[model samples]
Target: MNEYIQRCEALIQELPHDAVRQNEPIYKHTYTQMGGLADLFITPTTYDDTQRVLKFAHRNNIPVTLLGNGSNVIVKDGGIRGITLCLKHLNNIEITDTQVVAQTGATIIGASREALAESLTGLEFACGIPGTVGGAFYMNAGAYGGQIADVLERVLVLTEEGDFLTLGKDEFEFDYRKSVFSKKQYIALEGTMTLEKGDVVQIKQKMDELTIARETKQPLEYPSCGSVFKRPPGMFAGKLIQESGLQGTRIGGAEVSKKHAGFIVNVDGSTASDYMNLVRHVQEKVNETFGVMLETEVITIGEDLKDPVND
Candidate 1:
């Protein structure tokens, strides 16, 4: 084996019990059902293990990337360059009084359910958000007219130097699908949320209503990355795409979802390139029709889409 591969294997062998993976398929890991292979995917069982991995990577100048549930990102066909640290093993949820403390890898839906079980409100809006706690906090994820900024108290993040720090809500600088962590290079470790005591029945009712609304409106049956674009202020991204008559637009395997204009789904034999082509086409058409540029919410990373090979 080459020196680099040998080093990675050594590290993997010594990795925490929670952090074990080799040649793992990245496609199965994402919501989009795309991507290639990860050289080494590590899921640290504890914060110390996570820190140790990061420290080692930093010391060795090894590249590292943070990945959550793969709800909002697209992995390159070439895969990641170095160690892909997955926070999935960090999943943990705790409730004390009106507070909810959870590790970064815990799903937002799970956290909301925990809140409901505890009769704590303020998280009903996130009942259906398909992302991890750390991802949601970093992006200030929102739905149904509420956002993470509304209830976030503080977040625990790891510095690039492997130090942990607690940042308060104000320090987060949350604004419309963005946070301080989003701009800065920091890894979320866990978060503490402040909620309110409310009638569980009412909270559950709201959650159910939103769930139904999402089910009725979104194309959930297909493999997709949720909304492909962010709301463009004063105009919904879906509405704009629908108005531009861009729905059902297809470029190879990927198509602008007929059910929801905001989604780009893998219809059949779709590739990452197909998705990218459709996204570009939608942007072009929307810009042509409305004089407004539609910004993508789905994070894409891959090589240039190769032209289709003829039969």
Candidate 2:
């Protein structure tokens, strides 16, 4: 047997207690409900298991891809190579006074709800965001004029070297839809958010208002990668798409949402290529119309589907 094959088998045996599946379909894990497979999809039961898996992958030179809630990522049809570490089982949210601590796998919505339960005021903006805490920190996720940068206190990240490091919010170099964790390729384990003690009624009211607004505006019923494009310099991406007449534009099964121009929805069974192609088309049309090049907020990973060879 080849050394790589030997390593794969050995790693599986090492993590016997973890939920490890080989050549597993990843579509079910993502919000968009489309993907190919993961060579080794692992959901570690404990933090120690996470560390051990990382150490093993590092020592064996096996690439490890850390996924949070899979809310904003696309895995191509060719599938991912090596290990795919899903942190969904590590969900733990702690609240003390006005500060909230959330693990990587904990949903931002869940964290916000916890904040509301405690009468905290800062996370109300995130009550409708469909990403995990780690993802929110990685991308500085924002909505309703509030963002992670506004309340984040610190982050705990796991390095490629298998060491944990704590970084203050200021150290992240936070900006619109970006943070240092993405650039550094660090795996964020958790985040601390500082908030204000507020009246429960007011907290609930704000959260309810935002929830109603989100439900009213977004195409929440369909499978979609929430907002497909980043807001370009003082311009709303959805507005630009609407003005460009790209709404309801369909390529294969993927369509630019008529309800929300910023989102591309899977109206039928759509491949990653369909979504990708539609995104490109929207970018081209919007640029032609308004002279502003649009950037994507959604992330695509893995290889493209290869065309079949015929004799």
Candidate 3:
């Protein structure tokens, strides 16, 4: 057999599942329908498989990238090299009397619905949030005055060295938009959230109010990276952009949403470069007008199409 075939066989032996793909298109997974390809894409079927993949990649000195739900990330057009891990299949949510356990791949919105079904009260704020539980935990994602850190009790993670451990809320050091996961680059496996029993009617009412508020205030009709900028201290990012006359501005196919200045939406086919350019333009204009430089909440990854090495 040729060297390429032999190498493929060896890696497959280590991966031990059919959930692996070569040259996988990443745009299909993202909310904005952007991105190019991933050289090697893996959706592990179990926690054991995830550990195996991480350990194997580490042993072989292969670079590994993590993608969850793809709600707030922009992958450049040149695509990602090495192994890209997307744990979309290891999603399982279990609800108990006083808590809920969600595997990292499950959507936070789905988890909130499960909690509401059990008459739980703590997750009402997350009912309209996009992204997975892993993403939520990674960035301490929140909305409508509630954040994941408040309801989260602990988490299971695989360290960079391929060791598994559980960390409590305090260990996470949850801040405004970050956790230990963001600081230490830990791959979250699952999470446990402590909750309280509430009246189902009341829980649904709260969720409905938040959903309507989100749908009304945000541009949910288009594909976009939900919120592009962090809230400046004592100020709102959207309000600043709107006041600066940046709303409806377009860079290529990416446009600052006229409906909500906080969002950059893909009205047509948009590249990551286009999105980033628009982000920069909005920042420059807002800063020039009000001296408040907006900071990006969205994560950007992958390589540019113009990179010579990629050619």
Candidate 4:
């Protein structure tokens, strides 16, 4: 084995029942169907294992990136440097009286479904969110007028100091598509959500209705991130882009969805560059016409292929 791979393998041995991959294709892990290779990817099976990996990375000064369901990120084609930590193996959901405890890798949709089965309410808004608990908490992801901050009681995170701490809702500092946890770059391990007992039939009904609404409006059939841009203040992002006459606009193989202007879909075999360029094009044109800056909700990583504005 090479030096870096040997180092990662040694680190892996310190953990229990964890898997590691060298040069894993990141595109397969993301919703956008675009990304370069990951130098190293590891999924730990237990909290202790997760902590051990982090401690090792911290001590060695190896750069680490935490990944969830890969639903809202755009990785550049040049690939990622250092270790990419995936929590997919940490998925677990347990119920206790009024609260539900879940690992970071557990899907929000799965959590919402469990809520319905347990006759739990207040999590119906997350039935359609395509992400993990950690990702949801990091972004304060919400829909249908409900957000993570509304239901989250506390979160277990691994601090940079190699200590585990429980942060309450206030500590998270939830906002529109942002959180203090995100800013602090803390690694989330588990979440404890407080929900209410309600009628299972009613909860299921609400989830069904929301799912139908999403299906009718959003392009779920195509491989794309859920939303491309955050809603600018005082204006709906999709409406503004649509009104700016950018629907069906194309940058290489990427195109703003004709059905929903807020979406930048890979209509063909779009490279990461294509999608990013399309995003900037829409942003610039909308800003020029409406005098409103459209900020991206999509998180971008790695080096740019070219300056987007010039394309």
Regarding lDDT, does 1 or 4 come out ahead?
A: 4
Q: How many collisions between residues are there in candidate 1?
A: 0
Local distance difference test scores for all models:
0.86, 0.88, 0.89, 0.87
Query: Which is the leading candidate under lDDT?
Result: 3
Query: Over the stretch 141-188, how does candidate 1's per-residue lDDT look in tens digits?
Result: 999888999888998988777788889977998888788987876899
Candidate 2 vs candidate 3: the lDDT winner is 3
What is the Cα-based lDDT of residue 155 in candidate 4? 93
How high is the lDDT of residue 75 in model 1?
A: 72
Whichever of 2 and 3 has more TM-score, that candidate is 2
For model 4, residues 1-311, the per-residue Cα lDDT tens digits are 54456667778666553378788888899998888887888888888877887888888887788888889888887667778889988889999987999898999999999888899999999999999998999999999989998999999999865689999877888889999888988999999999999998999999999999888899887878879999988789999999999999998878898888888888787889998988999989999999998999988875555556787
Stretches of candidate 1 exceeding 4 Å from the true structure: 1-4, 302-311
Q: Count the backbone clashes (under 3 Å) in each candidate.
A: 0, 0, 0, 0
Off by over 4 Å in 3: 1-9, 307-311
Q: What residue runs in model 4 are displaced by over 4 Å at the alpha carbon?
A: 1-9, 15-18, 304-311
Reference-based lDDT, residue 181, model 4: 80
Q: Largest TM-score belongs to which candidate? A: 2
Residue 208 alpha-carbon offset, candidate 3, angstroms: 0.7
Cα lDDT tens digits, model 2, 76-166, are 8777778888888879999999899999899999999999899899999999999999899989999998999999989888888778899
Where does the lowest 10-residue lDDT sum fall in candidate 1?
302-311
**Which pairs clash inside model 1?**
none
